[model samples]
Target chain A: MIEAIFEKFFQHYNFWAAVVIIFIGIYATIAKNNLFKKLLGLNIFQTGIFLFFISLGDIGSLETLGIGDATPPIIWKPAEERGYLYVNPLPHVLILTGIVVAAATTCVALALLIRIHKEYGTLEEDEIIELEAIRGD
Target chain B: MINTVVEQFPALIVTTGVFSAFTILILGLLSRKICYYIVLIVTAFHFILSIFTLQHVLTKGRIHYWFGGWRPPWGIEYVVDELNAYSLIVILFLGLLGIIFAKRSVEKEIEERKLPTFYTVMQLLISGCCGVVVTGDVFNLFVLAEVASLSTYALIAIAGGKALRASYNYLILGSIAICFYLLGIGFLYAVTGTLNMIDMRIILQNLYENKMVHVGFVLVLVGLGIKAAVFPLHTWQPDAYTYAPSAVTLIMSTVVAKTFVYALIRLIFSVFTVNFLELYINAWNLVPWLMGVAIIVASILAYRQNNIKRMLAYSSIVNVAYIVLGISFFNSQWSLSGALVNILNHAVAKGCAFAAVGAIVYKTGIKDVGALAGLANKMPYTSGALLISMLTLIGIPPSAGFVTKFYLAIGCLEMQNYLMLAIILLGTLLTLAYFLRVIEQLYFREGNSTQKEEVPFSMLAPTMFLAILCLAIGIFWLTGIPLEFLKKSITSMGVIFR
Candidate 1:
């Protein structure tokens, strides 16, 4: 049973890796005191999801069908004639959009951080919270 | 099939909003004063288009527009079913009122230089909401939801000072929520390989017991629940509401939150269907219980707040819970209708309440609940609007809030869920307790200021209009005018009314 589980784990190592990276990113986001670090963690978290999505698009070897390594989804005459198994381009498109959204979020967060730093003279979350409490804001 | 002009209305409404955002940005460089007019014209146009869209849907049928003439399963589709059309009208109506009200409020609250950008972002926010409502694609929903949320963050941050922190907190949490929603989308995509909601729904009929599908459903629920500010997931809401500019607060609390709830309802009833919920997923069974806690707990929290906006923010949470609870009684037709009606009811009532509070802050710079003492004498129209809205919120007879509670109670009786019925009544009493505090302060208490200082006519008109709408909608529902439309929309969504 242990060997069977290990075999399955090794077969889907990419998903396991993605999950682990996501948890690490979540931990840093939740536990980090520095606001910049939190933003970095958030980016990391988003990157993990992006990785998961990209992995989902990968069409690995299908020996029974005699399919080899998946090719990029570039539709051309020769590739179509050869009948190459192209990877699903939809998830790639989705992740590209997701990446744009992540970048925008980061830009907004960084702008807010700059304003927060200018106002509070610190990037530490606890320090800022304490300051707010002291000022009764 | 671009056969007719009416078919293009859905795309036109959304594009106009996006186009106007840019127009405002470019034109504002020439003259900032034109930005408000641009938003006003665009929102008014949107409201008109929404009305026509609803009329079309009611008379004809669902209007489906495929992007680039691509087929449904492949390309993004814009659909205006009865529900979407109804939600569009509600959102655009509130949005127009919000824009009308923003003229003086924005000038007063925002910096002079930032006026153009403020109007631009507000336009984008409204368009994003329209996109969310109209789109039939789930991924498109995510993108539009992000657009709306990002614009919301910017609008809140524009308030500066303590608002900066509130906007930042909201940004982080909101991003996380969207990411979870995306993750849910990813899971469903992996399983079903389709992103069109209707297509996915058809494919998911056989896969209801799939573990991944279950996870996807739950993840979507969690993500949207946070966005909708449902009980436990509402940590970022109060701060965002309290610190955002008054216009921002009004739009965000009403239009933005209602759109998210509409999205939740769409996903639950349209995509997942009641069969999925009844057969496999029991997670929804917890919704009513959590909302029960939310109604009581949030009302108590609202009662304890010193800041008037903060109090209203907490009250917003309770109202959100009310909508969710009403809908969560999925078996009962009355409850579903009540939930849908409450969206418009709460939006009108809360929009007026916040507008009144904003007017108070605008003229007097008063934020405390206690400081509202004798406001009725100074700004009689604004205070009177606030009183009417507050009474509506407390579910008094012949008001919109009462209609929702009355329907919801009957819904509970239909389901034989007596406990939820009791909770609904208790929630009303609690709502009465908190809103009564403000009403008493508005009318009964003695204060120093007695000058006649009403807000600008532009602002006061919208506030009074919404307040009047609160009672008008209730009377209309009682007369079965709008309720028939709501029931038609609900039935069209495959929900049967007994």
Candidate 2:
């Protein structure tokens, strides 16, 4: 019964999850005062897309019904042991790469932030920009 | 086995370039001046690959090698036809020249502590460029482009000062450009169901009428145009080139922008047919015309500059316009030839010029073009190289730039595109006007109180070496191996301009 409800809800919820993640990411990036927050937002936004892709890979997870009270992903354990198969593996691979790239990029961004703080004596983006402006003048 | 080896000459050459770049990146970490050795080793390896590839293509024909032997539509591929092989040689040759020049030039601007990091970024940048040229996958191009861009960003930041801000601006704009590219790729993937360009071409040909695909192409064009620093989207380049470490300028000015522009060409001509863009010709026709205007505006802008580096930045903007304008001619033989040869010519000539200018900056700290009085006496070889590169920049006969312009003019004339020819002529005149001013300043003036140090021996040697290449390409055309191959490759190409 729960599985059926999830199947019905998932087809609709997948897009919302992506949209919400993207919104929160953008909001933090643009609206937040802290540079660190903006970076976090960017990560959230990036991960949101990652989730969307994962959701895409899970498009058919609900179709493998009536496995008679077995555990998930029971592949070839003699007849009755079989339950629902796992989602597609390709998006998982792509998302894995994305995660690695994201991690590297975030590390760089954070390092830049730290340098900006050390040089200008602040972690706020606007303050840093202002300091840089004074230096330019 | 021998036949297969011969058949895959182009692929091997490209991969060899890529592999050499990686090797340099790893091994370049050791020792202080070790980066120089790594660059030399890699460039030598790439140079040999270039010769063999060019010879193979000339003798046999088009060389297409599939990755994992999967054929098109289902598998990725790498192609080195006339266009690919030509640009590959241009990219690699200039890359070699750049590394050689950079040995002394880079060591000057870059502090000892940052030297290893500099070489690592350069290797990544070169490999990224090489990958852009050789890859047949559209998405793969975007990935490689970032590989180039991220390193380019870091390299620019090494210069300090407003270098960070400039790099930041570049990062923002570059991020937007890459995102545009990725978004466009997503759209393309949605439509074609394949990332391999040859496969995409097959699918796109069938769906040429699709509106979304048309939009995808425009997105790609815009994205790449920004990356290539074409005209309107070229704001980041001046700052990046001006503020970055001097050797970085040499590499960026000569190769990075040109690689992306060529990738743009590869997409339109090889991945999408002329018929497709033609259907929307009325809409897209402005692309070439805008390029024409960029040629004019950028040259004029070059002439208006105070800083020498900024002037060359604008001048490079003009050079990119020529390459792009060539693309707009569709399959026109003369235009394409002009565009193609200009690519190689500019690489050699501009590389020499930037190195010479950087050497000047290294010696006496003169960035302003107007007040640099009496520099020649103390730094004769450096100034002499400056003069030759200037002459070459002006497309003077027996110079590298001369041969390139000659071919480009022929391209314009063959198409009856007289306005483009006029633009070319005007651009050359403007180039002469700006560059000759520098020559006059250098050779005429005796000395100023501020002009303190003699040019460094390390810096002057490379400048003189590059200046020799500029003169030798024009004066000693018969014996120059690179030039000889250029002529052969241009002739062997199957595409006819008219």
Candidate 3:
């Protein structure tokens, strides 16, 4: 049982790594008080998701099918003739879109943070709330 | 030739929005005043196109346009069935009215230089909403939802001051929500190996017992629940609604929220289907209970708010719960139709209410509910519009809200869910209590000023139009004129009307 568990863990370590990184990012986003830190945490969280998606494309070796190595998703004459296995490229394309969305979200968030800092002269969430309370908004 | 071109309307609608957004931005460099006109023209065009799309859908059946002629499951697709067509019409209709109302309000609230970009983002937001409603690809829905959300955040922040904080908080929560949705999509794709919603639905049938499918189902529900502001995940709504510009508040509270709910419905009915819920998740049994909590809690919260906008925002949550509750009783046809009709009803009622409140804020700068006393004498038309909308929201007879409640009550009877029925009744009373406060203030008490100060004709027209629509739709529903359309849309989702 122990040996079987070890083999499974080694085989799917990418998913386990993604799980750990995702939790860390969530913790930082929730636990951190600094707005900038929170944004950083959000980025980390998204990056973890991206990693999870990318790993899903990687089909490991299948000795029964005589595919020992997985190549990148490229369609060339020699690779096709040689029966080369190609990693799924759809997830990569989806993640590329996701990355652009993430960048846009970060840019908007950063702009809002700048405006918040300019308005309240602070970057801490609690301090900003306090200032808002004192001002009676 | 015309038939072929009409087939391409789905893609044209969204492309017009994205292209117009940039066009406005570039053209505004030379002439800023023209931006509003461009938005008005484009939205008008979109509204007309949506009408054509709906007419074609009703007659010709579902329209599918593959992106660049790549077939489904391999390339992105735009499918406008009865549901999408209905939602598209409602979205663009409200969007056009909101833009018409925006002319005077935007000029007043936004800085002169920001006007061009403001219109640009507004166009993007509309297009994003159109994309969300029409697209058949789940990942495409996520991307377009992000586009809409990002524009919303920018629009709210453009108001400056307290709005910045509201927008920031919304950004954090909204991004997290969309990421969860993306994760859910990833899980489904990992298992099913398909991104097209129809393909995924077929593949998900056999995989319902899989743990990953179950987790993906829950994740998607939670993610959309936040976006739709379903009771527990609604922390960001009140602030965003209260601080956003009047036009933004109107559009967000009505069109934006409704589109998300439509997406949720599409995912539940079309993508996952009823069999999945019946077999594994038993979500039909679960969602109504949560919606019951939302109805009671959100109404009470709405009652306690001092600011009128904030109160309306909470009320918006209550109405959202109503829609969810209506659909959750999946066994009852009355309930499903009630939910679909309520989407149009609530949009008209709430859009009118927010526009009136915005006009009040525009002229008098009064945010407190108590300060509304005696303004009726000065702003008669505005105050009258507010009264009608508040009445409609309280579900009085011969108004839009009444139609929804009557159908919902009949639905409850059909399902024999007495507890939900009582909750609905109690919710109505609570709604009456809060709205009566505003109505009483509008007509009963004396104001400090007596001078007539109605909003511009541009703003008043749309508010009045929506208020009239509230009564007209109620009467329309009573006459059962649109029952065929409603039944067609609901039945097209593979739901049997017993």
- The most accurate candidate by lDDT is 3
Question: Which candidate order results from sorting by DockQ in descending order?
Answer: 3, 1, 2
TM-score of chain B of each: 0.99, 0.89, 0.98
iRMSD (1 decimal) for each model: 0.7, 2.6, 0.4
Deviation of model 1 at B299, angstroms: 0.8
Candidates ranked by lDDT: 3, 1, 2
Query: B14-68, model 2: which lDDT tens digit per residue?
Result: 5665565566556656566676777677767776776777677777876777767
Query: Could you give the CAPRI-style class of model 2?
Result: incorrect
Q: Model 1: number of clashes?
A: 0
User: Which pairs of residues collide in model 3?
Assistant: B374-B447
**Each candidate: RMSD:** 2.1, 5.8, 2.0
Model 1 lDDT at residue B442: 88
Candidate 1 lDDT over A1-137, as tens digits, reads 99988977887788888888888888888799998998898898899889888887875522223545566656444654444457878899999999999999999999999999999999998899998888875
Show the lowest summed lDDT stretch of 10 residues, model 2 chain B: B489-498
lDDT winner, 1 or 3: 3
User: lDDT at B306 for candidate 2?
Assistant: 84
lDDT of 3 at B231: 85
